[model samples]
Target: MFENGIVGSLIMIAVGIVVGFFAGFLYRKKIGESKIGSAELEAGRIIERATADSEAKKKELLLEAKEESIRTKNEYEKEFKERRNELQRSEKRLIQKEESLDKKMDSLERKEEQLQRKVDAVEKQKEELAQKIAEQKDILEQLSGLTREQAKDHLLESVKDEIKVETALLIKDMEAKAKLEADKKAIDILSGAIQRCAVDHVTESTVSVVSLPNDEMKGRIIGREGRNIRTLESLTGIDLIIDDTPEAVILSGFDAMRREVARIALEKLIVDGRIHPARIEEMVEKARKEVEVMIREDGEAATFETGVHGLHPELIRLLGKMKFRTSYGQNVLKHSIEVAHLSGLIAGELGADITLAKRAGLLHDIGKSVDHDIEGTHVSIGTALCKKYRESDIIINAVEAHHGDVEPTNIISVIVQVADAISAARPGARRETLESYIKRLHKLEDIADKYKGVEKSFAIQAGRELRVVIIPEEVDDASLTILAREISKNIEEELEYPGQIKVNLIRETRAIEYAK
Candidate 1:
């Protein structure tokens, strides 16, 4: 009975729980439906408001668009009216132009008719004049013995002969005056410059003779089996000559710099009393360093002396290297210094840039320092070096044109050129082999002899002046100027001379009658 009562209780609880759940779900569903219905109503109101706003906006936009269209249409009409008025004005101008053109055409037609009548009259006059000229020519040709062309040629020849004499005289007078003034001024300037400067010059030798204490020291220098001498030679690139000289040894080399180093190192080795290979090497290294120091110091001294500042360090070193350099036996460093002084003097007189001139003058032959190691002429090498060192264009040009290898672009370049010539051409400053000197003199004479009417040519004054003899019968006085100029030009084009060569042209007319 208890089991049946419990089962009834469970069934009653289950029924009650189901009824409560159903009641809550039905209440929520009704509430949700009412909320949805209100939301729908709100949505409908919002859509109606939006639709009303859109309709008003559409009317405003349409009204604005219509107003804009009307405004544009009025503008278009105004433009069209303006265009039509402009077209009417253009048509009126065209009609006026047509009337004016018709009037001009009528006037031009009358003028053309008058011009044609005048042209016909001139044509008749020309034909009559031509007939008269023909008759006159026939009569003149008959009167004269020569034809027209022959007479014209004779007249022209006479006039040409007279003109040639006058031209020759004029050229002579002009050249005389010019040369007189030019020579006077040049002598003054050059004399002044040359007078103010003087430096010791010598014909430097390629070989250096280092004296020794005695004959025994020579063997010491030669070393055991010539090892010491060989080491020095290999290191310094100089040849060692130990001969029958009583107390001297000679160091020979084309490179003065290496020869100098070898001499210093050899002297040091001698003084230190160390003759082994190791000691020789040590001395050589020390000597090299010493020479380098001297080079730098000399470079600095040169810059200070010349007052040329701001040279690249490498350029300074190069200037120092010139101390060991020589050209035609003249000490190159001294030459450069002399050239610098001369350039400054000349520049001062000419009112050129003195500083630039001096600077270029000093650095003009910087290439000689390393010309052996480098190819090309000194001028070319110097130009390349200056350019590489960021030197000014004027400086490079001065160096490049110093040797007449190129045309000078400025006054400084010309000044440098002049100074270089003056320095190089100084008597006793340079020398050449006997064969070359003779060959040059002969070549100069030969160049003068190549021209016509040249009886003889003598290169005198050490080949500085060429005296040319002209056959008086062949070359008249009137033609001497042209012949001299031609010969000078030929010499200039043909010869590579140190300095200026004076061309002295002499024409002699001699009457020699022998009575037997």
Candidate 2:
């Protein structure tokens, strides 16, 4: 029984130990399950947080993109609005320009129609004048005993004689009046300028003649069979005239520049002592280039000297042409310089714009260089050129009115006119033909001789006066009135006297019956 009880106790203990072990294992499994649950919950929280952060970041990114898109859209809308406004403004301006153009066209058309009507009116007036002249002739024929033709001739001749004297006096009076005012002021300005600025006149020649060393040099220049001379003449448009004048050769050409080219080339060839056809041609071409350089340089120098900037290059080149031009036996460039100086002085004295006046005066006669080829007078040509070069209106008007092409509108215009006259009227400036002078005197005398009842006509006072002696038998005191009228009318139609001519009609009668 004891052995049985021991075995049973051991069984119970083993069973109990197994039970405890199972309990402990069960407890451990529960705790581990709880810890696992807690860890799983924590893991879920971490995943949720990471998901929330991702969502937040995505939302932020989406908002930022949306904002950027809005900003870009705003910028595009603003740009589009600005462009629309600009387009609208441009369209409005274009409409306004079109309207202005249309108005201008209408005005021009209206002016043209008015001018046409005026022209027609003027034509009708001219016809009316002709008819009146015919009616007057018929009436005068009926009054006079002579035929219409004869009366017309006699009346014209008599009127011419009377008009000669009265016209002279009238001219003198007008001149005196002009001298008292306009001329006096002009003289004061011009004299003050001229007195202050003293300039020397220079003589210029058209031909550029070169002197050779000797007659022997001519043969070398001519080369064998005159080849050198031919080459030179062909290359340079100047004619090389090898005359009997020892050591003197004349270079003749219409172009002053070409003549200068020939002169300079010939001089170089002479100095080099190598005279041949090839050498002549090469030298001529070289000289041409050199002369062109000189021309451009001269233009640049003149612009620099004058202190007048912003001249067109073409205008400067044209100014260079004046370097070789001459007028009335005076160097044109020198004359221009003198005029500029004088004008400046006048401007100083008169409180006018000196620089502007001097510039205009210097360039006033620039057209004369090319006037030979141009159709208009020098003043007109120059004015047109100034207009072409876009010169000031004042300068253009001054140039035009220098020779009375248009009326003087400014003080500079008057200054230019006076200066031109002064330069032209200077001693040895111009030469007149003897035939013209003699014809003028005869014309002056013949004007008074055609009067009726005039016994004799004498042109006295250096052909200034027409003294007519009328016989008392032929011409009575009352008839002198008609004679004077006839003579005066004729002078107006035929003569172009500057000042005047006096017509004196002397009528005297004497009777001596007892002595006879």
Q: Best-fitting candidate, measured by lDDT? A: 1
Clashes of each: 0, 17
Report each candidate's C-alpha RMSD, comma-separated, in the order given: 22.6, 30.1
| lDDT, residue 46, model 1 | 100
In candidate 1, stretches whose alpha carbon ends up further than 4 angstroms from where it belongs are 1-204, 426-516
Reference-based TM-score, model 1: 0.46
Error of 1 at 159 (Å): 44
lDDT by residue (293-336, candidate 2, tens digit) is 88777767776676657777766777777787777666676677
TM-scores, in order shown?
0.46, 0.45
* lDDT of every predicted structure (CA atoms): 0.90, 0.79
Q: How far is candidate 1 from the true structure (C-alpha RMSD, Å)?
A: 22.6
